[model samples]
Target chain A: MAERVVEARHLSKVYQMGDVEVHALRGLSLDINRGEAMAIMGPSGSGKSTLMNILGCLDRPSAGSYHLDGESVANLDDDQLADIRNRKVGFVFQTFNLLRRTSALENVELPLRYAGVGAGRRQRAIAALEAVGLGERLDHRPNELSGGQQQRVAIARALVNEPAIIMADEPTGNLDSKAGADIMKLLLKLNRQDGKTLIIVTHDSDVAEQTDRIVLIRDGQVEADRKLGRSKKIASKGK
Target chain B: MDFIASLQAAIESITANKLRSALTVLGIVIGVGAVIAMLAIGRGAQDSIAGSIEGIGTNLLFVMRGDSQNQVRNPQPLTMDDAAALSDVFQAPSVINVAPLLQGSATVSARGESTTTTLNGITSEHEAVRGWSVSEGEFINSSHLLGRSAVVLLGTAVADDLFGRHDGLVGETVRINGQPFRVIGILAERGTGGFSNENDTVMVPLTTAQARLLQRSTPRSVDVILVQAVDADAVPQASEQVANILRTRHRTALGADDFTIINQQDFLDTAASITGVLTIFLGGIAAISLLVGGIGIMNIMLVSVIERTREIGLRKALGARKRDILFQFLAESSLLSLIGGILGITLGWLISVGVGAIAAAANADIVPKIGIDSVLLATLFSMAVGLFFGLYPANQAANLQPVEALRYE
Candidate 1:
């Protein structure tokens, strides 16, 4: 009954290392509805990162049927996938990926620039930075900001596009626990208040405990799919 | 992304490593500057030489008394009779004027000042043949020759030396080798050009100089004859005709003549080939530097791609297509070359102007000029080098995978 934001019937990815064929993913199929906060957890070499890359449209599966918002994406060309990624999905990497020496406002406006959204772009960027509590650091470069502030700016960049879903791969991996907790809280609040679909890929159980659903991957297949009832009720409406 | 924004990003990156970018473009600057300065010098030298040749008289041809290799004094040298024969209307229509010259050096004095200078005894027709015009008074005429008048014309430098800028210079009497001669005319002050200075000699009538100044007998012989052709294109024909007449007059077989001829067109052709070869030599050396500059650009661009791999990854993640990355690096490298080109042109212009100033101060004829061609060449060369050298590195950057680039440490 819910609107499906991500639907993967069968997914596989193979990497060639010299003469060896390494199967990073094998027949992995998963789905996430709109406005849901979920975590994909796996150990190293379990293909969770590959799955996240495939879901984010940054990498295509070797064999799969992927339907994102009812559009067949598995057979799309590179440029077509790039267009889809530009307009539909936002990615948050573990390193924050803020451009060095670039102002926080400019970094946030980068996606909008690629999307050809002009006229009042700076104002929108400013508004997004303000939403992330980075209004005072608009002019500051990445080196000028603290780890927490940088991650906040990265979040503003991802949210600026208002994509169908946000994919975060170990977003808090490089932060101190305090900064990590703050980032997790921000992600949780975005899901609850703004009704945004959030997918966080990680190896930490404690971090995964904050989400509403958990899909554990092992050897590139779904090992467990569990639903959680947290202290705050999960929001079901899309903003 | 829009073009302006891409350029802005490129500029930001270039400014981020200002020292490296400057060092990278130094080769281009030097190369372009060398090209422009060399072209100016070559162009200036050719122009100066051409001007002097024209000043010597484009339609003039010379008939020396002897061959080019030897200056022999024959029992029968070329006389006014030969000049008359060459100027006869039926014999050669292209011959405009023929002037016979008998040259000698003597100590000339007026009042207390004296200077040793060459004196030329020539006919009034010398004015038309040699392209020398009097600025004051009148040149020696036929009456001066028939009467053997004790009158002379002072060259510009000669007048300044003997009269010391004195007024009434035309009326002043200058004694030459002990005989006082009245100054009837003063030659104009033409600069020392590619040819000899025309303003540094004194002139007298041919018959008077032969009879009185040098005291020679009748049927006197002259040293050289000046013949003016009707036009530039007729110089070869006029020269051949004069040679043929001289051979006949001397009663010699062909190629065994007593006199030799030098035409203005032959001198011009020799001068042009010399300057042309020199220009290509200098330009070829400068173009080598440009090739070196192109290689330098390629080397720096490769290093830039490696240094900014993470940044490339970041842009790709930020939704930049392959073209976006390609354009960014290409624009950055080309901006480097464009800036270098502008700087080089400015430096070249300054050096050329400095050369001209030095030449002028040294009383030299060379005046270097920077024209539009060198400007256009420098600009186009730099841009072409930038684009051509920027190709491989930009492609390398653009072809980088977003995931691998993001993963690059």
Candidate 2:
């Protein structure tokens, strides 16, 4: 049995929208093991966002238990959740959320700064940027870079802390076809070479085909969990 | 996040919006500058007043007729005899010198230039007791007072009024109330001191004035008796001694004496209290502007927090804790004020120096005083305003939900 990095069972979330109860999630259960690249896909209102938020530690489940990397985090307070997010879950957003007017090197070092990693921050951030093929663009601000380069910087920021899982939400949504392909290639490289578990939320089937498995959600429940390749180790080695 | 990172981030944010940051800092700059300049002017006025008070001879006592407005019996006027008694070493040992003055306003003409000015009948002892020295020729001598000769010493203003100059007036003749008196000396300028213009008086021999210019009902009644104590420490003793001698000489009871004693220190205390109040008043008005500046900071901070909502969401998603966001905003606001405070101090110092320059150009005796205490107070107070006013907006930023913030346009 491969070591499970994420184990969530029967999760549910209800939002109070001004005296109306809106159910965002309902009895959702999923599991992701170490070093696996998985894509979560659903329609706009199918509760995929809520699941991503819960699994990414940006939010807690209103009901049910969740354990990430063997720690029960379903009932963690806000600060404790923040710590878990810092140490375990790295995020890459659709908009390439590199801080404006900041150098790529500094943007990549941001996570290390928040994690209180002192003295060796520059070395680690430089290594991460180099891993994304942006070592020479370290001094360039976000606006000075191409859309693909900006996303690379975002990926570097995500990788600097070596989080257990990199959660990418439409990471290539705003890029051109060429840039999107390049970004996908870089993300897969990181997953395969470093054995980093990757979870992507995307609506593009082509992007989903690149992952080892795909989980489809509907009406706040997992509708299908499909495997497109062999087991985790074989898939990573084959890629 | 650590303090250094927060500070760096704050600097980056402020520099990104240069115009807005400068405008925000302008409010604080004006507030602190106004506060410092007002305090400096107030202190300068206080210092000039103190300087004039000290310029008057120290340890001096003024003996005047008591207040008789509410009294039934009229108070006896001070006389030359009382002055003579106070000068007696055995009777009042603390009394160093006593100079009797009999003064009245008169019209004096010299070289067809006439002006109505104060005429004083003063003995030779008046020079030492009043701290006025002759700038040209000689002062009133004992022989001149004894023989009751018509000799006069011209105060600078009177000399300038009569002859268009202060010096070279020796042996000149000036008429007082239709009587001619020779100008033997010109008195040096003494500026204004303690309710009277010292340079606006003309002096003549006491005997000459008594016999020729003005006469009283009593043989030797005088208007004021000026007594000098040995030193500052001897003023109270000298006052008590002079009061006792006058009570005995006039045969009046204690607490019902016919004379009043005024000391130089009384003027100092009164002037100090008045200027102290003026300083606080000026500073209080300036503090209102400082409060307004603080509100300006709060307003700008609130706007900044709203504008950076998406950035805050991104930070939180990237694993920034609540305090990290809180500290970033707080650091930005206080850094605004801190920079403003430093620049404001420079602005304030420049204003004080400018005021001093203007005063000097106007020939006024004021020098703006900028003390270190005021500088320190303005710096600390402005920073506190920034921090205090920054709390609400920073809290709003820290308490934002990442999902909603990320969704915000």
Candidate 3:
């Protein structure tokens, strides 16, 4: 009964390279409600990454409409998109795109700086790092940390702004099985405990299974949507 | 970002690329140094020349027989009669003194030592007209002229050359052009004058020099007439009045006037104008080097933009405005030039002081001075060069598309 935080209707994205035309998205339609954890899975070249890009506001769909939090996202300009990305959405990348020479605390403070939050940036950044269990590693740079630790710092950076939704693209694509499971647990905790809308795109069946709902995609179309378990809360409460 | 943070970042970035930044600043340093040094040297030379000329007396005028522009036209020379006529006819309140000169050069021998020396014959007024004095004995007087004595005044150099460390050769006799003449006085040292040594000269009474030394028939034609104005301010009027009297005496028309009258103040003005031109020329050449330095800054800045493309992308991704990028780059380039400019000015001032010290030690007339205005100008010029050359690369960085920039390897 929660309000839909993301709405898409007949969205399509096409790319032109020289004389060739490519379709990245084909008339995609979906809705993601608040406080829900959703996973998008597909084979290679299945337009799932493109859909994630559009959903994260990193790219725009070429056709049809997208409404994020009841606002038409399809018509938003680059600045407005950045505003939305800064205030409403946080992105976690699989590559752990933390600045190489900067410390973990500074990396987490990057979003706050963009948001023009001047005072107590260090304190807020430390809180975010502690939220990801990285309080002791706040001063370590990405090169000084392990792959899992770096991903944790990146996630901390994404979460520091307290956005409405967290969109992660293959959040555990580069990690081993154990580290990947640890990252998935953290994302699930953020969703269930914080009541944040979580949307993840991945190829791993284990990662897809941990989400509340799995939306299977193929050839740029949604093939199926299925609920998993009792949706975390119901199971935890023994309902 | 705030200006202070941006400036700090710029400083850090420049420090990271130490070699490139140093080389870029080196260009500006050399340019500003050259400009300051050249102007200092040129000004020193001009001041030395003007000082020496002014030392000869500013209230004096030289009336020569031929015009400078029409050297081919031969004219009759001024004689003793003409000199006397001017002394009588143009006896204005502004005219202080008049001395007619008959000049010739000869080899003089004393004590078996022989040296070539200039010989000048004049009356007692000559000493006042040229602002010269005697170091030993007395200058030609009315009594020396009336007696028509075969007496002469030896210049310091001439006396040193012919008499060799002798003290006061006033009573001694030296042979001038195979004729014996008594050395009545010794003239003080007056330093070099253009191409000749002003001190290596002899002075004699006009009547004695014309009648006895050369034995000319028609009262030996005077080569130059020296005139002294009563006051420095009266020099112009005195020169004009003397020119009129000379033209009437010589019976010459406007363009055909035989004598050339040069006022000392007018000579100084001309010298100053020439010095002005030389200063500009030197400054212009130095400015070219500064321009080259500016281009060097631009070239290095462009390379820096290429090297830091990924940094630009990262900053833009973190919400840096285009103006922030522009200002950061500008601050870096400006800091480079400003440092160079400061060093260059210091180097130039040190050079001037060193040269001045050397000149003073050697008792030379050169006086090199570095002006405060030049330092200020050089600083301003360096900043301008920084801003101008830093623009292209700053614009290039500011205009980078964040998406494409992030993808830059």
DockQ class, candidate 3: acceptable
Pairs of residues clashing in candidate 2: none
Q: What is the DockQ of candidate 3?
A: 0.26
Residue lDDT tens for model 2, A89-148: 889899998899789999999989889999999999999999999999999999999999
Please give the ranking of all candidate structures by TM-score, highest first, separated by commas. Answer: 2, 1, 3
- Candidate lDDT scores, in order, read 0.86, 0.89, 0.82
Task: Determine the iRMS, in angstroms, of model 3.
Answer: 3.1
- Predicted candidate 1 versus true structure: per-residue lDDT over B206-275, tens digit per residue: 8878887765454577888999989888888888888878888887764456688988777779998999
| True interface contacts retained by model 1 | 0.49
lDDT of 2 at A168: 95
Better model by TM-score: candidate 2 vs candidate 3: 2
- Lowest lDDT block of 10, candidate 1 chain A: A230-239
Most DockQ-accurate candidate: 2
Report the C-alpha lDDT of model 2 over B137-158, residue by residue, as the tens digit. Answer: 8988789988999988888988
Docking tier of model 1: it is: medium
